[model samples]
Target: MRLATFEHLGLRRSGIVDLGGDGDDGAVLSPFPEGTDLLEVIRTGHVPATGAALPLAEVRLLPPVEPPSVRDFVTFEEHVEGVRRSVDGTAGVPDAWYDAPTFYFANPCAMVGAHDDVPVPPGCHALDFELEVAAVVGREGRDLSPERARDHIFGYTIFNDWSARDLQSREMQVGLGPCKGKDGATTLGPWLVTADELEPYRDADGLLRLALTAEVNGVEIGRDLLSNMSWTFEELVAYASRGARVRPGDVLGSGTCGNGGCLAELWGRRGDQDPPALRPGDTVTLTVEGIGTVSNTIVPGTTPVPIPSARKRPRARP
Candidate 1:
């Protein structure tokens, strides 16, 4: 079943999307209640259709859940290698990357809906988008083993990790961040597809053999198979849960895919003449085979607030 949150009749509600309903564009059914918290529904695991079904076209979709936390992992070796080459002129991935699934915490408060407008962050020129898949945690777990991690996942959603590449490059030079470079905006939606709905696409090896693709304006930029990940979602979740608790509504991203997931990777491979960075008015759309698509348009950013610059302090005598 696909779960979603949408605005209908000037009120926010949670419901199940019925793609084959009597309406011309299907309908949204099983609405929990007006102002219902979707995250709480995921925790209880009970979704009842107590309200009337609304025509899908009449409702504006929102991010399915307001995730409490988001952990995005770099699980694709090709992506890592390409990005490293672009940033460091190196073609090989770090040895540590192969040892474990490395990740970074993203700002949940910065999330936007599937079709919302994303602003190009202030002081950023090299804007980019990462095509990724994210799993939403349904059950709470701590120090989980990879084998037992699958049960904790509730559903999947397409993730667009919007980036400010120029800012990212400058910040990482000091060895510690992608913070402001990435926190500007992140996209999560279309809807959340329950894990069981995707069982048909799951291979015997436990990899979800879903096809993923990205496009800008109307041209296809990159495509890849979800099976190409170096590590599984289970492993990523286990790693995230190590010594910490993963609760319902927490999100775990499958990172950027290879074969052109982002413009940075494309730039690294073909140089700057080809695919250009995202600009205001450009639209980015990402499609995951079974889960669906999330598209957002770029808009101009707000002017930044002025701040005092830091200065060096004199050394004290020992």
Candidate 2:
């Protein structure tokens, strides 16, 4: 089912979306049981099948699920190769990456629904967006094997890992993270499609075969098949669960797909001639087959908020 969380008159509700009609705005929804929210559905591993249809256009779309914790995993080989190649011409996929999936914790508070304006975080001059697919964790488990990891996933949704390439490049030199470079805004919805809805797309090996794409102002920038990912969501979940617990409402993302998911990669590949950094009023849209498209427009800050920098100080002894 195509499920969504929406708001109307200051109330947030979870529901099933009915896209059977004629027009774009003709979308309609049927709410879940009263007082039930998305987080509750994920926790219970079940979403009721019946609710009255209400026009989808009449409500405000919220993130499909407001996760308790979010973890993004880099599993696409092409994307990893592109970023690595940007850093050095001879670099190939990281060898260690083949042995295990790598992941990081992200700020869920920074998320906004699809169509929401992505405010230029103060000081972010080179803002960019990453097109990704996220897996929502369900139930609870620890030390889960790859064969069982898929069972813990409740659903999937498009993830836009909004980025500040300039800040990311500078801070990553310290080797701890993409920290403040990221953390500002990450977009996560139009709606969430349950795992069962995607069962037909899953291959014999357990990898999903959805085709994914991203565009800026209606111009396509990138595209890739989700099946091309070197590691599957199951492996990512298993790896993430080693010595740790995977709980309900935790999100795991399939990091940026093929090339052009972000400007940093584009600039690294094409140099100074690449497209300009995101300015106010630009819209970025990402689409994944079997899921949906998410579009967010950029809005610049009124005043510049450059990141503070530090300089070396001379020692008295010297």
Candidate 3:
């Protein structure tokens, strides 16, 4: 089922995308027991099939869920190696990556929805977007095995991990974080497709078989089969759940796909043929087959939030 959270009558509502009415002029139906949000529905673990449908045009869509927390994992080796190569011309997915999935928490408060405007932070010379997908945790669980983790996935949503590459490049030199570089505006969705909706696409090995494509202003930048990911959602979730509670409304992202998903990787592969930096008025559309698409426009920020200066090194100890 395609589920969404939207504003209707000045109030936020959650629903299933109902296409059977008006011959394709589909509406969104608040699942049985309307008024509660998608997060509550996920926590419920079962979407009741009966509800009243509202015209799709009657509301403005919001990110499928206002996640309690977001953990984005770097599960694609090619993306890691390519990004690392672009940054330093060395360091393939380090042996540590092979040891286990690595991830970081993002600012859920900064999340936005499809067609939302992403403010281009002033001084961000190399604004970029990541083509990615995310799975929302259905309920709370800790110390889950990969086998158990698979059962807790509620649904999937498209994520455009907006980036400030130049700022990112500067920060990583200190070996700490992608902090301010990311944690800005990350786009989350047009809709959320429940895990059951994608069941038919599951391969024999239980990995999802779906295609992901990214486009900027009508130009196709990249495409890849999601099944190519080395670390499955199960592993990412399991790793994240180890000794830690993963609760309903939490999110886990499948980092960038292999090749051309971001400007830095494309630039490294193309040499001087770099794609232009994302700028005001530019639109980016990311689509995952079966799940849906999210298109966002770059807009100017009201004022530049000055970038913080890195701390200077202390005098060498004698």
**Which candidate number has the best TM-score?**
1
Give the whole-model CA lDDT for all candidates, comma-separated: 0.88, 0.82, 0.82
Per-residue lDDT value at 118 in model 1: 95
* TM-scores for candidates 1 onward, in order: 0.95, 0.91, 0.91
Q: What value does the lDDT take at residue 109 in candidate 2?
A: 90
Candidate 1 lDDT over residue span 1-318, tens digit each? 989888777888888887774643555556777767789889999876557777777877889999999999999999987877775566778898888998899999998998899999988889999999999999999999988999999999999999888888878887775878898988999899999999899887788999999999989999999999988888889999999999999999999999989988877876562588888999998999988888899999988787777678687778
Which sections of candidate 2 miss by over 4 Å? 21-23, 48-51, 85-90, 302-318
Each prediction's number of clashing residue pairs: 1, 1, 0
Where is model 3 more than 4 Å wrong at Cα? 20-34, 46-51, 89-91, 307-318
Query: What lDDT would candidate 1 get against the real structure?
Result: 0.88
Give the total clashing residue pairs for model 2.
Answer: 1
User: Residue by residue across 1-318, what tens digits does model 2's lDDT show?
Assistant: 888998876888888887876745777888987678888888986777657787877888889888888898888777776665553343667688878778889998988998888888777788888888999888799999988998998889999898877777777778787887788888998898889999999988778999988888888888788888778888888888999998988889988887777665676666552677788889999989988888899997655556567777776683
Error of 3 at 80 (Å): 1.6
What's the CA RMSD for each of the models? 1.8, 2.9, 2.8
